[model samples]
Target: MSHWKHVYEKWRSFEQLDPALKQELDKMADNEKELEDAFYTDLSFGTGGMRGELGPGTNRMNIYTVRKAVNGLADYLVAHVGDARDRGVAVAYDSRFKSQEFAIETAKVLGAYGIKAYVFDTLHPTPLLSFAVRYLKTAAGIMITASHNPPEYNGFKVYNDDGGQIVPDEAHQIIGCIQEVEDELTIPHLQKDELEAQDILNWIGKEIDRAYLDKLAEISKLATGEQQQDKDLQIVFTPLHGTAHDLVLRGLSQLNFHHVDVVEEQAAADPEFSTVKSPNPEEHQAFTMAIELGSQTNADVLIGTDPDADRLGVAAKDSSGHYTVLTGNQLGALMLDYILTHSVSNLPTKARMIKTIVTSELGRKIAADYGVETIDTLTGFKYIGEKIREFESTGETFMFGYEESYGYLIGDFTRDKDAVQAAVLACEMAYYWKRQGKTLFDALHSLYETYGYYLEDMSSLTLKGKEGAEKIAAIMETIRKEPLTEVGGLDVEYVEDYLAGERTVIGTKLKESIELPKENVVKYILGNDSWICLRPSGTEPKIKYYFGVCGSSAQEGQQRLADLKRDMEDVISRVHNV
Candidate 1:
């Protein structure tokens, strides 16, 4: 029999399988391809932790897989940290299907080892989970979510004692422990009642929520001596039917923003994300309902957040009274500008901004204009979070951190991308511009006029399952072996192979090593300072193309961006054919 067939029979023979998973397995018995995909390999547990479609497989986010992953975490903590049982993991979940169950499983797995678990009583945003780790003084944290993914997806993100996502070094250690497990299906876990009886299952909620909001409010005071008026600036918001609903509402109120309007249709805790095709705020289509509500209410700006509220999307009324959704890059620049301009008294000598390699250079330019240095890390919010901890220890001030995927952080209270804090700060920015008789759209155009028009965009191609994984690897290899000399009719000035940790000059052939940690990414810089980057998604079965170009005018910038995207898409298409 085939390898997958043997594994399938073995799984079917297990007696203690969950009833739902067992039924799913029995129903797909005749589907050979599905079975192979399910049993082909284990779900990846990288720096981002494990994420996949929810189903009954080692490669899925089922109870057994979650338990197995948690078993490794428990062991890693016990083997590495002293007094780990006393310093437990802070666990939180979003509104995704079975998120709560997975969170409970995580606690149970730890409890079986006599480790404490401080779990949130209800669904919460990912950032708050990070905050709870520090606020509750836990050893680590685990967030149950697949931020901005489709309804069928769920994930587990593990954070270290610093409350950021686990760095690669620690992730590898956990993986080593996970590989040592003899049988994931038979991993022993304490029952919920038993865990509570042992006093290792600690439930937390209102106190942490209040603490996060209070810290956010304390850090968001833009003008020191001002009482903060501008309540007339109308705003519309939608949480995209996820965990952010109640806390975001409370956060806005805490910030004293009274003219906020919400999209009731999408304001509830919904696991299916019924109103949209996908829950991601980065997509303009996800802002449709928010834009409608903003138009109806004649609001000055519209803000929408993904399920876990780690990523935020914004739309502002343009000159023609039409709401235009701003790109993540645009929002980042605006927020940086506002932070630097209004927080002069709060600025430290070493204040700086942090962004990923894939993010646009526009924000960097803006920070330069304000004299705040911009730092780049690999493309993950965890890296930015890690930097926050570094800045804390090094005495440098982390003014802001953001990614090009609608994730931003204004304060270091929460390590991950904080859409709730961003929402409040964005509202403050909108009002600041409103007070100047301008909109955020006006501010963006001003920024473009001052610092040449910078346009940014991203394209993602999803390739699923085992064959798709191999195809993605093949595509990456092909590109690395045979580099592109030019793109969009411009000469490739230099190529940065992050996997190889070197930047190669095209004409001189001189190579210099990159200082950042090595990652599987390649970036090509064009003659005109426009750049393109290609990398496989760490959390999803997708490859992404990031494009950025600067031009003397908006029309010219848009044209260049379009040409680059078209050329890159063609290249990807050619690879797909191969």
Candidate 2:
């Protein structure tokens, strides 16, 4: 009599179910727990779209689920855009399992709804998908990728016409449309031949790629006249078996950087990402192959991009000849410093930079030093993209935007964080430092000395499945009920509860409204420029704790950051017990 059981029965009785899916259902007939887990509820689609393990159930990602999602998007488009077919939707997929299939399925669904679909001929990076939305002037866009998740996981991301992820309001509307569908198994989709004959599906490739790379080339600082001096700077680059291998190589080569070496083992388009435990560039283990290549080539710097090539990670050889992975915050600071310092003449008079609430304060300081204003948005690169759009309307220039999770954007040509541009900028930074007889590590030290020592660290705890989801909600509720007054032995100056849309001053308890859109996040400001933020991951089932502190010396900053992390962990443990 359970809802999931009833849904499972309906699916089992469906005559048109795919044979493979039917086989899976038969295999799970005797397994009650497995059935419950797979059919408990539909995979929740929000601003980030749906992500889950590949399987044959409502909670898993399959052809049925993909069709249902696209059906909802198609309906939403028809409702919003007057001529949906004319506006169309652009589609791109990465090198993930079933990515191409999902992309095609999405196109078929849209075509059945009389909406045109512009799809890439092959796998492309997420940023390029964003660019294609603007280039082709589509009503929306969809990207099929899990974006650095493990091989077992895949996802879909939806974007608005502005080339950014759908904002909260639009996401709610699309969710309503998705809920209206009574059965995922019965969602309509046109045959490929039918769509092609009707001209409802268009294939896009070389022209868009050329336009995007040309725009990226314009953002390069080293492409001007200093390429000759930087041509000898050794650089090791790896795409982590994603979509950046060819484009990044082509971009770097066009910039006249001849000493770049690619990690051959990881150059191929690999969905399994067999070389790394996880395709995430944020993890140190993901750089193993690139580090090995860096050592062999005596490269000055190493750069790696995630599976979708939107997030970038960098490692620089330190003084001791050991490769050290730079944190996302560190890399952002370095890129901001290099870009702002070198491009001062060309920067707009009212230029500004943006960072996420969970990102480090060091970027704000770096922006301040360069006389640029810094704005903070909720976590997620989409919010950054939204800010870029806002700036465009206001005639304000967007200098740079980044988050602590290795996502960076230099030019607004693409709304999302672009690893292609980041990789090239990082290489150029390394070469510039080389001309000064220094490594990026040395440059970072100099930055710390100039801007005071700032340290940041993030910790995430993954809680999976339905029970884990309930536990996560309970944890957030508990924290909201009993807000921390102080952390790490520092007095809490103020508390910003984004979910409640209020900032409460600790001593006076005077609350003010927060201007940003509502999200389930809480941040506690402490004395001595230390702070902590707690928020659930948007794309993953994990609660992340971001800790930051500023100190007069590197040793002091490291110790303070350690203390903050310990305190934050204790707080999480206490809340978990509740």
Give candidate 2's whole-model lDDT. Answer: 0.91
Q: What is the C-alpha lDDT of each candidate?
A: 0.90, 0.91
RMSD of each: 1.2, 1.2
In the predicted model 1, the residue pairs found to clash are none
Candidate 1 local lDDT, residue 273: 91
Provide TM-scores for the models: 0.98, 0.98
lDDT of 2 by residue, 1-578 (tens): 99999999999999999998899989999999999999999998977699998888999999999998988888899999987789899999999999999999999999898999999998999999999999999999999999998898899999999999998999999999999998899888899999999999999969999999889888877646675443877888889989998888888887887788889989898988988898888999999998998999899999999989999999998989899999999999999999999878777888899999989899999899888999999999999999999886798899999999999999899999999999999988888898899999999989999988999999988999898888888988888889888788888899999999999999895999999999999999999999999888887889888999999999999988888888889889888877
Candidate 1 lDDT, 118-207, residue by residue in tens: 999999999999999988889899999998888888999999998899988999999999988878899999999999998999999699
**Candidate whose lDDT is highest:** 2
Query: Model 1 TM-score?
Result: 0.98
Question: Model 1, which residues run further than 4 Å from truth?
Answer: 224-230
